[model samples]
Target: MPGREIINLQVGQAGNQVGESFWNALLLEHGLDQSGAYVGTNPLQTARLDVYFTEVAHTNSQSKYVPRSIQVDLEAGVCNRLKSGPLGKLFRPDTYVTGNSGAGNNWAKGFYTEGAELVDALMDATRLQTENADTLQGFQVIHSLGGGTGSGLGSLMLSKLREEYPDRMLATFSVLPSPKVSETVVEPYNAMLSIHQLLDSCDLTVCIDNEALYNITTGMLKIKQPGFSDLNGLISKVMCGVSTSLRFPGQLNGDLRKFCTNLIPFPRLHFLMPSYAPFHDARTQAWQGTSIPELTAALFDRKNLLVACDPRFGRYLTATAIFRGKIASREAEYAVHDLQKRNSHNFVEWIPDNISVSLVSVPPVGQKQAAIALANSTSIQEVFQRSLEGFSAMFKRRAFLHWYTEEGMDVMEFSEAESNTKDLIAEYQQYQEASADVDYEEEQEEQEEEGQAFEEEQQLI
Candidate 1:
């Protein structure tokens, strides 16, 4: 049978920038260079590169590989820059979808106007990529949940994907803006609206927080003043970790569908937090002689996490540790034992085997060993809480309402979005409460029975 094929759809400036880094990482992992030529001949490194690219015959009797990826943006500058970059040859020129004018950070304009105008074209490109695949798995969208084109247009595409390909799985790697420092004042509005759509349509949504990325870049990577490029590089590493099984053969979670099935029990609780250990690059020398126990321990550290949240406080519905690079099966078992002993309090009482382990021998380029931890925990509730607070602060004063209202969006839409967000928050809270060892419902029933017994005794007396 043909392997699973995933079409990547990157929207907006943030999406495209991150996508570029992701492609670079993928190429490096597969031992390929910018020109699609093999740099290393390691037989052990067996990643199914054909899943994301198609080989075409060049005039010089050589084959050129182009990615099964679509790049969409409202502005032309970012897309143009990507085309001129080192990895430009990897993408098809026709896959660049741009609009005449930008959304100006207005979600309404991006969704109602630009999104509608470009939907047909976007679908056309998607269809072409899907047709090329032997066994089409689904799409993986990279976008920011707090930007106009990334949020609004991305939401539109997600809804359309569900309608068009109901059987195929849809996942998103959604970037969230930092609450402390954000570029757009109306980001909460964009985030809320996009989240509403994602909750309705997507199978899974992996959240990457900007504040967490900033922290990782500065503290972990040791970058003095980190830019988007630095953050994108780190984000790409997390994506690679998540995608390692899909690319290479593994004992567990060998594809996107399996990965989702393992992590997500409830549809609404699909927001995942990822953490990768032993952060290194070309300039930074790889740390030598690290034990599996130490590496596994680092995966649970808050400083290593890609999202700024405390999973220890909230319950973890599901968790998986994906170990790449020189890790033995025996070592993996010991690591899992240690992890379970240390984190028994982190799991839900209902789930018997909530934690899973997947080991792959294919190490990340220039690293001895690396591990990624993916957790579906109620800790993500804080992220939504921040978004709700921000949205409420502006909505209470009716700030920036005209921007959306003038773009043919009804004022009631805002209320509906807020209602959906509140519902989502409630669902997470319920999950957190359910994960506790004490059953509040059972306790309440016992208390009621005791009161009834006391009343009967008093009557008899």
Candidate 2:
């Protein structure tokens, strides 16, 4: 048996059971059995690995948050087992004494500290490496980023790893919450920014949208039935699928691409808003510069993304093309058009009359996912050419647009906001620059200022 090794970490209430079950499924799929031991054995030349767990406080009294922990596991049994000391202890979970309930204003900082702890643990676990440096070269490291545990804390942890091993590959897979299940709009937005931070650091990132998978699997498996396992099976499959894919050495494929390639040629993407949205109509219908960054940041640069919106289905946005790979400008336009047509095939078409576009990019880093954005040209003719290319095909295909309407005034229309693409790029660049400095507070203050100004404008509009 060939052995493999992985350093696994999880934050918050998401425990070992969840990670183990997911890993077991992946191993079984590959015709390999998991050797209970943390090191390699001859009969099962099992993968030697380590595992760790950490739990964090949940924000809402009703919410359950788990701390971030790290572990290393190896596959091996009996005589083949390597002596375990530091490696063994490394897999054990450790707890922190703080329940600070991180101030809401600096919640990001608290989360970042949790990640810092994980980074410290990693250093300790691998300390022996300085003397026996070759021991870790063959092993792969896997981490997750999603929900509260992964998104917030996970980003901090992964950012540290990037600093340690700039050349080594680390994979992060995020399980995005379904719009309906996510209680707050800010949760997903935070997830996106956390992802942005990760993307700047990892080899590749794969994102699995809970909503889309739930829809697909729930329909086929029907969770209501006993033992159906319903969408849970889909979740397992997705996790196992991503793990197996990452184990191999090559171009990393993500769930986002899966949605883009296997699902309808084009999927509508939109950001949903609550009835309380003050500028839904103003932002949606009126032309404005300030909103573009939010629009583009929301729409572009996500993997396996079909649409954007909240559980209320308050607003909708869809994706059109893959930013990377062989896909071209013309083909991308056609694909978007095809998706729009399908959305409006019904008698009373409700496909968005206008769609927003923005350019975005994600450098290979802290994430193991894909990023996408709209293409722009130097002149109006070029823009018109791409628009015509996309719209004409959409009108012809009709399948690109889907017809669906929301009930109640709870759903409101907002002008698709525009986020100055240039501004976002600059902010990203600034973050990169500040990342090296010991003091990030000054830069963070600037970001808060920017956000405040934007919010103030929203209130004014």
Candidate 3:
């Protein structure tokens, strides 16, 4: 029986593709071969394999580890490929589900017509996975906001999940649209609508975009023209980094609920900016030497971020640094606190000691050291703002409104999405501008209230 198990639900094409890469990396790190059988000598890796893998024993005590994951799409193409893919044998047959008609890159089509129909089957499959776990932690959904299936249908699934599992923590690896890699004309609408749902439903969302992916692959790694596979590789590595603490034993935090609390300050401000250290091309260089100080600096650098927005423009409400490899506890603690002290302006003054750190003994495969930082900075609102601008521009003209309206969606829904998104953006700005003076004033007001209460009691006596 698995303890603190996380059932993965990868939605749509982008989600499934990224899920493949993510699972492959997990398999390698856990020392499991393609068939999900343990082949590595590291016995410690298998000690906690039950977090994501289910073991079945056969004759001679031979065990097969199947992923506790669900693969779903509105269309059959992506799921079919996964079924025939190299690692297909590792997944259970019942975990894979797909509908015949595609979402057609239209958010309304997926949400109302096609997606609503398949959500029941999706819930049934999810229930099966949860029943198998002795103690289930939560779900980690991977999908993009650019396409219909991922954005529209994905939102539909999220709403239902939140309703069904209200207490469970729901996290998402959400891929946003970018100007550099434009996919669909209606991407703005899809992205905005999805974000509105994410605001209420998701507990924590790690946001990444196509534009940033292109910049990193072309600028840092020196890839000429990075395709979807190359981009997904970067995402998979970061996902691995984020999960390293949960998958293995960590010093401070070792579970989804704990880390989610560490990274999130407010309920609505749970979006994080993910960054990885040592951006080196495998061909040109093996890996960079990592010091706690250097790794910390790299994480704050805009170039190392997986999103287009600059962290310098906004204030950091909170951050979590997960360090993998042989990190000295004393050195890491000193480095993080010292860095925060010297660059006090970079972090919001209202939150005291906002950054949290976690250490993992095992390093990522094929690397000496690695660190991933998830920053809940105000600048992440830039991602939403960009989509809002595009969405407003199109909505003003009533361009391509029929595609959604014909699918039985009301016109007021777009208005609601836009208003909710703007409110979120405003909320971030409110926190970003919070200062030491504001905290001091708030504390003085609290003291005055206490003093008044005491004086009234004395008079009454």
Candidate 4:
């Protein structure tokens, strides 16, 4: 079967910057140059580039290359820099979409006003790109959940995409703001609003927390005070790891559909926690003689996780480890068995076989080995709890309420979003509790019988 075509939509400053790094990484991995010209013919390189990029015919020599991506921002500065940057020639000029002004970190303004204004133009660009695909797979949206353009406008685009292409899958690489160090005071509100929409619209949401990135840079990569570029580079590697399967077909879980099915069991429990091993930078020491077992063990470490959470506190519903680079299948099987033995304490008693492993032989540009562990564990509730507390604290004080109201959003919208978020948290908590033991089914059956008896008694009365 032919591989599916994926069009990338990057929104906001954070999105565009991350997209830049992602494309740069892609180029390096594919042995291509700044202008998309193949520099080396690596026998191991995969032939999946056309899925995410288009080959435009050159005017003079009939050679061409451009990314099948759409870049949007409320402010034109980031987009302008991207167009003028070294990799400018790799993007289609018409794919760069922008708006009149920035969203000013106000979700309501981005979603209600600016998003409404730009939806038509965004759809036009998307349709034009979609027409070129032989079999359109889905979309991968890169954005932060705390910024106005990323969260607000991103949410609006997600809803529209779902409406327009109901059958296609929609996934998001959502950059989550830190609860302790926030650039915007209303970041909690923005995050909640975006997450509410994501729960309803997106097929999968991969959350990358800012706090986790900070820790990884300072602790693992040993950067004193990492800049956005530094952090985005790390994120790009993780993105590459996750996309390895999609880029290179393997024995199991190569496509996005199978990947999602393996990781996400319940619809709302789709918040994934990823951890990449052997993270290296200039300052950090090279990973010396690390065995597959050691690398697999490192994946379970909290410090290596892309999102900060104590997995020990919650039960694992489903887990998938994607191993890339030079690793044997027997070695992978042994590593997975070792991981299972070590993680047995955290596995739910009902389902011991929830863990799975996929091996992708295609490694990153300059890496010998890498592993990404994606888990749908109940520990993500901690993140939701922290966000909810921050939101409730500010909402109770009625702080920053006028900013959204001034943007023409009804005050009731906040209440609705708050309610939805609370419900989501509760659902996660319920899943966690249900996964604790095998007796949950018996308890649910008894509760149903008791409720039916009460209804019968009421009818008799």
Best by lDDT: 3
Show model 3 residue runs off by greater than 4 Å.
none
- Runs in model 2 deviating more than 4 A are 1-5, 14-18, 27-110, 113-119, 126-146, 225-232, 242-461
Q: What are the per-residue Cα lDDT tens digits for candidate 2 across 1-461? A: 11123344433322222444454444443333333222212221122121111112334432211212344221112101212421232223332212223212121432444334444654565443322333222222333333344455556656766777665545544554444545443343334345445536554444444455444433433444423233334344444333332232223222222322322212111111111001112224344332222322333222222222221111122222222222233444544454445543311122233232111122122122222432110111221122233333433544212210111101111001012222333332332233323455777889999999999999999
Model 2, C-alpha of 318: deviation from truth (Å): 19
Residue pairs of candidate 4 with colliding backbone atoms: none
Instruction: Encode model 1's per-residue lDDT on 421-449: one tens digit a residue.
Output: 89888988887777344676788889999
Q: What ranges in model 4 sit over 4 Å off?
A: 44-46, 59-63, 281-287, 435-461
TM-score of each: 0.92, 0.40, 0.97, 0.93
Q: Indicate whether candidate 1 or candidate 2 has the larger lDDT.
A: 1
The best candidate in terms of TM-score: 3
By summed lDDT, the worst window of 10 consecutive residues in model 2 runs over 409-418
What value does the lDDT take at residue 265 in candidate 3? 80
Please give the RMSD to the true structure for each candidate, in Å.
5.0, 20.9, 1.4, 4.0
Q: What is the C-alpha lDDT of each candidate?
A: 0.86, 0.33, 0.91, 0.85
